[model samples]
Target chain A: MLAFQAGNLGAFQALFAKYQKKIIQFCHRFCGDQAMAEELAQEVFLNIYRGAAGYRPKARFSTWLFQIAVNVCLNEMRKEKYRHRIDSMDASPETESGKPRIKELCDPAPDQNELLEQQEREMMIQKALMGLPEKQRLALSLRVLNGFSYQEIGTQIRCSESAVKTLIHRGRQHLKELLENLYAGGDKS
Target chain B: MTCPYETWISAFMDGELTPQRADAMADHLAGCHGCKAKYEALTGLDQLLQSLPELKPSEQFERTFWKKVADWEENRSRRRLADWFKRGWRTVLAGSLALFILVFVSVFQGRFTRSLSPEEIILAEQMDVLQQYELINNLEILENWEAIAGEDESS
Candidate 1:
C-alpha cells in the first residue's frame, strides 16, 4: 500500500492478487450472496484505490482493508433493496414456492451426496450466522472468519477489546442455540 | 445450572486469556463439567465456521474491476473538466461586468471634466459679463413697471 501510494501502481496489483480471495470470502460470509459479494468486493477495492492518496500506515494494511470491507457490507445491507431482501430472509427460510430452501438448495446427487451434505451444513451455518444481531455477526466474523485478534476486532467494530470478547462469546452461544433448534426441527420433520 | 466461568471458557478457547488466567481456567475446566461442555461447544462452533467453504470470484473479476476503475477515472476527469469550464465562464462574466462598469463610470465622469471647446470656454469666462449686460437691458422695464401697469389698466 505504501508503495502504491508512492506511485508504484504494480504494487497495488500485487496487493490485490494477495487479498482478493480473502476479501471476496469475507463479503460472501457477510452478505450470504456470492454475486453481491463480488460486487461489494469491487467497491471495497475501488474505495481503497480512490483513497490511496490519504493512505497512512498507522494500522496494518489488512486491518484497514477489512475495515473498509465491513463498512461497505454494512452500507449495502442498510440500503432499502438489501434491507427488503434481508427482511424476506428473516420472514422465513423459504421465500419461494412455500418450500424449505435448505432442501431446495440441496438437490440429491448419488455421486455427490457427501458434497451435498457439506453444502447443506454450510448453508445452515450461514443461516444461523445471519440470524445473529449485526454487531455480533460482525464481531464474530472478524474474529473467527478473518482471524483478527480481539484488539483488531475492537478496532474494526469500534468497541473495547473486552466488549469484543463478550460479543464473540454471545455470538457463539447464539449460533449454537440456533443450530440446535434448526437441527431439532429438522429431526422432527 | 449455568456456570459463571463460561465466558472465560469462551475466551480461553480463543487463547485470548493471559497465561496465568488461562492456566487457572484450564484447571477449573478439568473439574467443572459445565464449563468444559461450554468450551467444547464453542470449539465445535469455531471449527464448523472455519470449515465453511471458500467462495471464489468469477474468473473475469479482475478484468471487470479494472474496467470499472477506468470508467471511474474517466468520469472524474470529465467532472473536473466540467467544473473548470463552469468556474472559468463565471469568472470571465464577472470580470467583464466589472470592466464594463469601470469603463461606463470613467466615460460618464470624463463627459463632465473633459477639455472645454472654444465656444463653451468663452461662454464660461464671460458668464459674469453676460449677466451684467442682461441686467442693464432690463433696467428700463424694471423702473417703469408701476406706470406700465397703470397705462394698461386705462387702455
Candidate 2:
C-alpha cells in the first residue's frame, strides 16, 4: 500500500493479483452472487486505490482488505435489502446418515448423483444463510466459510472477538434450525 | 438449552474452549444424549459450511478490475487537475480584483487627500498653475499652425 502511495502502479497490481480471488470469494459468500460479488470486489479495489495515501499499517493487509470488502458489501446489501433471491432447496439432500458429512468433501469431478446431492445441500445452506440477518450471516460466513479467526472476524466486522463468537454461535444455531426444518424430517414445519 | 454447557459445545466445535473447559464439556456430553445431539447438530452445520465450495469470479475478473482501477486513477487525476485549475483561476481573479481596487483607490487618493489636508492643498495649488499641459506639448506645432494651414490651402 505504501508502494502504491509512493506511485508504484505495479504495487497496486501486485496487491490485486494476490488478493483478487480471496476478495472475490469473500464477496461471493457474503452476497451469494458471482456477478454482484464481482462488482462489489471492483468497488473495494477502487476504494483501496482511492484511499491508498491514508493507508496506515493497522493490521494485516488482508484484514484491512476484508474490512473494506465487508463495508462495501454491507452498503450493497443495504441497497439491495429487498432483492435477496433464495437458492431453492427443492431437493435438499436425502441422506440417512445421522451426521451431515463426517469427512471433508472435495470432488474434482463427482458422478451425477453426487453432484446433484451436493448442489442441493449447497443450495439449502445458501437459503438458510440468506434467512439470517446480514450481520449474523457475515460473521458466520467469515468464521465458517473463510476460516477467519474470531479476532480477525471482529476486525472486519467492527465488533469485539467475544461478540464475533456470539454472532457465529447464534448464526449457526439459527442455520441449523432452518436446515433441520427443511431436511431433518421436520419438513412439515 | 437442556445442558448448561451447550455454549461450550459450540466453542468446543470451533476448538475455542480451553482444555479444562473442553474436558468438562466432554464429560457433560458423554452423560447427556440431548447435549450430544446438540453438539452433533452444531458441528454438522459447521462441517456443511466448511464443505461449501470456494467461489471464484469470472475469468476476466482480473483484467476488468485492473482496467477499472486504471480508469479510476485517470479520472481522479483529471479531477485533481481540473480542481487545481479552478482554484488557480479563482486566485487569479481575486488578485486581479484586489489590484484593480488598490490602483483605483490610489489614483484618486491624492485628489481626495488634497481636498482635506493643508499640505496637499498647498501642493495642489502650486501644481495647478501648469494646467495647459497639452497646449505646452504642442507649442512648436501650434506656433506654425497658420503657416501649415496656408500651405494646405495652396495645395
Candidate 3:
C-alpha cells in the first residue's frame, strides 16, 4: 500500500490481484447476491485507489481493507434498492412455502435432483443468513466465512473483542436455529 | 435449553480461551451432554459457512476497473484545469480592476490639483482646521473669560 501510495502502479496492481477475489467473496457473503457483491467490490477498490494518497498504516493492511469492505457492504445494504431485494428474498415463495419455487430452482429433471438439492440448500442457507440481524451477520461472516480473527472482526465492526466474541456466539446460534427451522419446514413440505 | 457454557463453547472453538480455561471447558464438555451437543451443532454451523460456494470475478473485472480509473483520472484532470482557469481569470480580472482604480484615482487627483490654484490646494488640505479656525482663535479668550467673570463676582 505504501508503494502504491508512492505512485507505483505495479504495486496497486499487485494489491488488486491479491485482494480482488477476497473482497468479492466477502461482499458476496455479506449480501448474498453475486452481482451486488461485484458492484460493491469495485466500489471498495475504487475507494482504495482514490484514497491511496491519504492511506496510513495504522492497522494491518488487510484489516484496513476489510474495514473498507465492511463499510461498503453495510452502506450498500442500507440502500432502499438493496433493502428491497433482501426483503423480497425474505418473502420469496420458496421461503414461505418451504419448497423450492419451481421457477426459481435449477432444471427440475430427476437426473438433476442432486444439483437441484444443492441449489435449494444453498438458497436456504442464503435466506437463513439474510434473516440474521445485521451485526450478527457481519460478525459471523467475518469469522466463519472470511476467516478474520475476533480482534480483526472487532476492529472492522468497531466493537470490543469480547463484544465480537458474543456477537459471533449469538450469530452462530441464531444461524443454526434458522437453518434448522428452514430444513424442518422443508421436510414437512 | 440454554447452557451457560454455550458461549464458552464458541470461544473455546475459536481458541480465544486461555489454555487452563480451555482444558476446563474440555473436561466439562466431556462430562456434560447438553454442552457437548451444543458444541457439535455450532461446529456444524461453522462447516456450513465454510461450505458456502466460492465466487470469482468475471474476466472483464480488471479491464472494467482500469477503464473506470482512467475515466476518473480524465475527469479529475479536467476539473482541475477548469478550476485553475477560473482562478487565473479571477486574478486577472481583479488585478485589472485594481490597476484601473489606481490609475483613475491618481489621474483624477492630478487633474483636480492642476485645475486648482495653489491657495485652493492649501485650503483643501487644511479644510478641517480652516472650518474650526474661528473657534480656535477665540479659545484663549474664552478660557480667560471664566477668570474675568470670577474676578467680577469677587468685586
Candidate 4:
C-alpha cells in the first residue's frame, strides 16, 4: 500500500489481485447479485485508490478494506432502496438441469438429487440472510462467512467487540427462528 | 457449575475462547444433554455455512475492472489539474498587484527628485521676457538715434 501511495502502479495492481476475489465475495453476500457485487467491489477499490495517500496503518489492511466495503455496500443499498423479503429457497428451474448435468460430468460421488436439495437449502439460507437487517447481516457475514475475529469485525463495522458478538448472536437466533417457522410442519422431537 | 454455559458455548463455537475455557466447555457439553443438543445444532449450522459454494466472477471481470480504474485515475488527474490552475491564477493575481505597487513607487520617487518648484519656474520665465524687451528697445534706438537725441536735448 505504501508502495502504491508512492506511485507504484505494479504495487497497486498486486494489491488489486490479492483482494479482488475476497472483496467480490463480500459484496456478493451483501447484495445477493453477482453483477451488483462486482460493481460494488470496483467501487471499493476505487475508494482505496482515492484514499490511499491517507492510509495510515492504524489497523490491519483487511480491516480497513472491509470497513470501506461495508460503507460502500450500505450506501449502494440505500441508493437502490432495496427492500428485504423472506421466502423458501428454490432453484431457478431453467438453470438447474443444465448446472447439474455439468456437475455430474465432472464428479460422480455426490448424488444429483442430494446436490439439488443442498443447493435449495443454500438458496434458502441466502434468502434468510437477505431478510436479516443490514447491520446484522453484515456482522454475521463478516464473522461466519469471512471468519473475521470479533474485534476485527468490530473495527470494520465501527462497533465494540462485545457489540459485534451480540449482533452475531442476535442474527443467528433470528435466522434459527425464521428457519423453524419455514419448516414448521416438521416435528421438533 | 452454574456459570452461563450458552455464552461460553457460542465463544467455543466461534473459536474465541481460551484453550482452557474451551476444554471446560467441551467437558460440560459431554455431561449435559441440553448443552450438547444446542452445540450440535450450532455445529450443523457452521458445517452448512462451510458447505456453501464459493462464487466465481464472470469472465471479462478483470478487463472491465481495469478499464474502470483507468477512467477513474484519468478523472482524478483532470480534477487535480483544474485545482492547480485555480491556485495558479490566484498566485498570478497577487504577484501582479505587488509588481504594480513597486512600479508606482519607483515612478513617484523619480518625479519627486527631478521636479521644479512653482516659484523658481515663474521667476525664470519673467527673466527671459525682460531680456527680450531690452533687446527690442536697443534696436529702436539704433534706427532713430539723432531724432530721439534732439527731442531729449529740447526737453
Candidate 5:
C-alpha cells in the first residue's frame, strides 16, 4: 500500500492481483449474482484507487478494502430493493437446499449428479443467507467465510466488538433455525 | 460452587479459555448430559462451517478486472479533458455573444429608435405644438378676462 501510494503502478497491480479473487468471492456471496458481484468488485477497486492517496495505516489494508466492499454491497442492496423479494422467495421451502433442485428437476443432468448436489447446497445456504437481515448477513459472512476476527469484522462493519459478536451469534442462530426448518426430516439427532 | 462448567464450555469452544479451563469443561462434559449436548451442537456447527468449500474467482476475473481498471482510468482522464474543453468553449462562446450584443445595441439603438413611422413622429410633433398653443392662450385669457368682466359690471 505504501509503495502504491508512492506512485508505483506495479505495486498497485500486485495488490489488485492478490485481492481480486477474494473480493469477487465476497461480493458474490453478498449479492448472490455473479455478474453484479463482479461489477461491485470493480467498484470496490475503483474506490480504492480514488482513495489510495489518502490511505492511512489506521487499520489493516484488508479491513479498509472490505469496509469499502461492504458499503458497496449494502448500497447496491438498497438501490435494487431485491432483498425483500429474495427473502420472500428464499423463505419458501422450495429453494431451501443450497442447490437449485427445481432446476435439476426440470432438466436432469444425469452425469452431473454430484455437481447438482453441490449446487443445491450452495443455493440453500445462499437462500438462507438471503433470509438474514443485511447487517447480520454481512457480519456472519465476514466472520464465517472471510475468517475475520470479531475486531476486524467490527472495523469493517463499523460496529463495536460486542455488537459484532452479537450480530454473528444472532446470525448463526437464525441460520441454524432456517436450516433446521428446511432439513427437518434429516437426522439432526 | 462457581460453575466452572459453563465458563469452560464457552472458553473451550472459542479456544480462548486456558488449558485448565478446557480440561474442566471436558471433565464436566463427561458427566453433564445437557452441557455435552450443547457442546456437540457447537462442535457440529464449527465443523460444518470449516468444511464448507472456499469460493474461488473465475479464471478470467483478474484479466477482465485489470482491463476494466485501465479503461476506467483512461476514460476518467479523457472525461476531465473533455469537461475542461467544454467549459472553455462555453465561456468563449458566451463572452463573444455578449460582446456582439453590446456592439450591436450601441451601434443600432439610434437607427432603430429613429426608424419609427412618419405618423408617429407627426403625432408627437402635433402634440408638442398643441401643448404650446394651449399654454399661450391660457396666459392671454388669464391677463384680460378679469379686466373685461370688471368693465361689464360697471356698465
Candidate 6:
C-alpha cells in the first residue's frame, strides 16, 4: 500500500489482482446479486485505491478492506430508490407468499422444471439471508461462507469477538429454524 | 426446550470457547439430550451453509477493476493537488499578515500599531465603531454651538 501510495502503479495493479475476486465474492454475499456485487466491488476498490495515500495501518489491510466493502454495501442498501423498491417488493403478494423476489422476475420453462426447483431453493436461501438482521447476516456470512476468523470478522464488523460470535449464533439459529419450517411445509404439500 | 448452552454451542463451533468453558458446555451437551440434538442440528446448519458454492467472477472482472483503480488514482492526484493548493494559500495568508505587522511597527512605532491579541482586536473594533457613531450623531449640535454661545453672552 505504501508503495502504491508512492506513485507505483505496479504495486496498485498487484494488490487489485490479488484482492479483486475475493472482494467480488464478499460483495456477492452482501447483496446476493452478481451484477450489483460486481459494481459494488468496483466501488470498494476505487475507494481503497483512492485512500491509499492516507492509509495508515491501524488494523490488517484485509480487515480494513472488508470494512470498506461492508460500508459500501450498506450505502447501496440505504439509497431511497433501493429501499423503496425492496419495500414494495416485500409488500407484493408474490413475495408475501415466501417466494424469493428474484423468482418472480424469472420464470421456469416446463421442460426445465427440475432446474427451477434448484433455482428456487437457492433463491430461497438468498431470501432467508436477506431476511436476517444486517449485522447478523454479515457476521454469519463472513464466518461461514467467507471463512473469516472471529477476530477478523470483529475487526470488519467493528464489534468484539464475542459480539461477532453472538451474531453468528443468532443468525445460524434463525436460518436453521426458517429453513426447517419451509422444508416441513413443502413435505406436507 | 431452550438450552442455556445454545450460544455456547455456537461459540464452541467457532473454536472461540476457552478450555474450561468448552469442557463445561461439552459436559452439558453430553448429559442433556435436548442440547445434544440442538448441537447436531446447529452443526448440520454450519456444514450446509459452508457448502454454499463460491461464484467466480467473469474474466473481464479483472480488466474492469484495474480500469477503475486507474481512473480513481487519476482523480486522487487531482484532489491531492487541490488540497495542497488550499494549504499553501492558507500559509500564505498567515505569513503575509505577520509580515505586515512587523513592517508597520518598524516604520511607525505606537503611531497606530494594530498589535492586539485576537480578543482585544475585537474590543478595539467595537470601540472604533462607537466613536464614529458619536461623531456623526453630534455633528448638528457642534454646527449650532457658535450661535448658541453668542445668545448666552447677550443674555
**Residue-by-residue lDDT tens digits, candidate 2, A68-98:** 9989988887674426432322332222222
lDDT for residue A96 in candidate 2, whole number 0-100 = 22
True contacts kept of 6: 0.65
> How many pairs of residues collide in each model?
0, 0, 0, 0, 9, 0
Please list all clashing residue pairs in model 5, or write none if there are none.
A97-A124, A98-A120, A98-A121, A98-A122, A98-A123, A98-A124, A99-A119, A99-A120, A99-A121
List each candidate's DockQ score: 0.30, 0.30, 0.29, 0.23, 0.10, 0.27
User: What is candidate 6's TM-score against the reference?
Assistant: 0.67
Residues A73-139, candidate 5: write the lDDT tens digits.
9888887454554545545434333544334332344457665566666666766676788898898
Report, to 2 decimal places, the DockQ of model 1.
0.30
Query: In angstroms, how far off is A84's CA in candidate 4?
Result: 8.4
Model 3 reproduces what portion of true contacts? Answer: 0.65
lDDT of 5 by residue, B48-138 (tens): 6555455555556677777887898899899999998978898889999999999999889877767768987786778877678768778
In candidate 3, position B154 carries an lDDT of 100
**Docking quality level of the chain pair in candidate 6:** acceptable
> Candidate 3, chain A: TM-score?
0.86
Q: Residue by residue across A1-189, what tens digits does model 4's lDDT show?
A: 889989998998998999998898888777765667778898899899889999998888888899999999988888734433111113342222244322421234477677777655665676667778899889988888888899999888898988887788777767776666655633453
lDDT of each: 0.84, 0.77, 0.84, 0.77, 0.73, 0.77
Reference-based lDDT, residue A32, model 1? 71
Model 2 spans with C-alpha error above 4 angstroms? A81-109, A184-189, B90-155
DockQ, prediction 4 = 0.23
Q: In terms of TM-score, how similar is model 2 to the real structure?
A: 0.70
Candidate by candidate, in order, the iRMS in Å equals 3.4, 4.1, 3.4, 3.4, 5.4, 4.6
Pairs that clash in candidate 1: none
Clashing pairs in 4: none
Worst 10 residues of 6 chain A by lDDT: A89-98
